[model samples]
Target: MDSPPFESFSRVLSETIGPLFVSAIIGGALQGVIGGQAIYYFKYNKADPLVMKCLVLFVWVLNILHYFLVVDAIFIYTVNGHGDPSSVSRLTWSDIAIVLVSDTGDLAVKSIFSYRVWRLSRQWYLSVAIMTGALVTFSFSLYLTITMIQSPSVMPNAVGTFGALITLAISDIIMSVILAMVFWKRRSVFPTVNRVLRMVILYSLETSLVTR
Candidate 1:
């Protein structure tokens, strides 16, 4: 008639704490990269466009907020309420906030790349396609966030969340491929530029692989 002593704790670790820890580690590393980019931009590209500078600042702020939300959730559920059955029975607001902020950060980064794809390719059709995919991914992510907030347990929203993640991954792959193609096409035109473009392509692929 009674559950095992470790049942609640195991469920909580599997459903929330484990995933949050992994996410926090990866997100923290990414935020570090973004910080490095910010430093480089301010140091070497002082004359860059105002819009570009603003976008960088926006992403920095968004990612920081995301990291904060994730840390807060970990503190609330694992650190403060550790081994508490009531806390493990349902998802919390902090958990939902982490999802929301993480999705928002992803959207912001994808938007920047979408614009870069457009600027480099000078092709309206490709840009439109990438932008459309980004929007759809964002929509699904928003739906997932809403469902998580409404649901008592994460299991109920698993399918929706997985679908959104798949969509987001596909969108990222498509954008990376298109950007690589753009670089490849121009490599022949500018021999001296090929090395830089190759590095860019490799970096794009690297990030995409990490995300997947």
Candidate 2:
């Protein structure tokens, strides 16, 4: 029999593995904060050995996911496309699914940090409000991701790119505000939260350079 059609091959790669990689990177890093926080909390409190051990395991898993995400994105966007826009056609549904999952993972990470703030200051109201806002932001991101992929003709479109950038910028601002609040509410935890935010901002700047 003749080889399967181009569409079938494209569908297989884009749908099956594309999301896996993108989510791996995006989700992995977001979840990594959760893992890292757990580790630090247990260590500082001198918690049960079981909990400590589990944190270590989680760290490894999240790190692995981050690594795979990088590999997958590069492969799909560059190697597979082979210097031709025609090489990559429609955005498989999987692409949209990956973006949604990754963005949700981001919200989760933010909530986890906000909860940490609550623990530090017992500011339940602030934590709940921030968490709700984060959810809304992620929901919008998910919708935009779906729309962009569903309409492949919009790829590299200025409107879509701006939408994504605006969402991310808002997210970064929210994260910064949370960090500032945490820093002010509990001076003791300032160093930790501030350090993380600094690294996050620096990485974002570096990534922007590469993208440009």
Candidate 3:
């Protein structure tokens, strides 16, 4: 007898594709928030230079592209591969291609933030360290993206995944600590100034934690 409709999809969801689908859904929702914010910024952003606006638009474009890719990826598994149980095991071009967009966006944001940090602290060493961390992440992502493109059926390497996570964790820790120290060094004698700086440090730490 032929299997019932959605049976394969149900199985995949129950077994393998559930987490990915949930993540995609969450990402789509976040993208909506980003789109709204982008629109708001464009409407009210009179002070930002033209170049900065363009940069924001570019990043927003990447986010939109990533959202579509995520949708397409799920669509391929649920709609295109509807009857096949093994389709979820195989990687699609979308899966491999997403790394490029995601990594490029991440690198751009990190580079911008690190550049600003360098401007504020004038710390060449901290900038270099952050850049080096970003480089490690980009290298691993590029390698994985290429490897998957060449062999779509190949599963991700454990060592590569671990290395990437470790590099990211180390980088975030360094960034959080270095930023706190930099701000702390600028502490003022006034209680109010010190309180504001402490709040900034706390916010920075919290932001890093979220990214981590």
Candidate 4:
């Protein structure tokens, strides 16, 4: 018997496709922002360190790869494996790949900010604390990826997933607060510095909203 209308499509939609679509859209926009920043960096910061330039290029490449993987997965489901029961019923390797790539991208971004926090505050202890949280989050993410690969038929452990998310959120919030405080402290030294710091503070808060 033929499957009910959208039975396969709806199953995939609810389980994976829909969320991936939304994420792709948002991630694409953020990737654009990063691209713009990269161009600006090259144009204005010619004297910046090679490591900093390479970091921007690395993030841009990862973001592009992440989006490409998502699109490829969607194509595989809707075109290559269209109406295949097996395809709609369980998570594919592509889905797992998306998760892994996303987690890696997140870690890269967080690590960059952790370094920024250290540079701004010059506080070794605070930098270590932030990186400790990041390391825990990365460990949990790795665990989730392994479990997903091992048991694609089963849902991931909710507690572990949520734990990783919570740790990431807390770490981001701490970093944002530290950055804001550092900017505030420097705001009094020079009027030009105060203006730049205000802009930095605003950007930090705006970026933090994504965590919410």
lDDT of 3: 0.79
* TM-score of each predicted structure versus truth: 0.85, 0.53, 0.81, 0.83
Give candidate 4 regions above 4 Å deviation.
1-15, 189-196
Off by over 4 Å in 2: 1-67, 92-98, 156-164, 187-212
Model 1: colliding residue pairs: none
lDDT of 2: 0.59
| Model 4 pairs in collision | none
For model 3, residues 80-182, the per-residue Cα lDDT tens digits are 9876867877888888778878877776666766776787799888888887887888788787777777777778765655666777777777777888988
Residue 166, model 2, lDDT = 65
1-91 per-residue lDDT for model 4 (tens digits): 5667567567756677778778778877887787898789789988867876776677778888888888887777778777665666566
Top TM-score: which candidate number?
Answer: 1
For 126-192, candidate 1 gives per-residue lDDT tens digits of 8777777777877887787788777757554766688778888888888888888888887766666
Which sequence of candidate numbers ranks them by lDDT, best first? 3, 1, 4, 2
Each candidate: what lDDT?
0.78, 0.59, 0.79, 0.76
- lDDT of the structure predicted as candidate 4: 0.76
| lDDT for position 55 in model 4 | 67
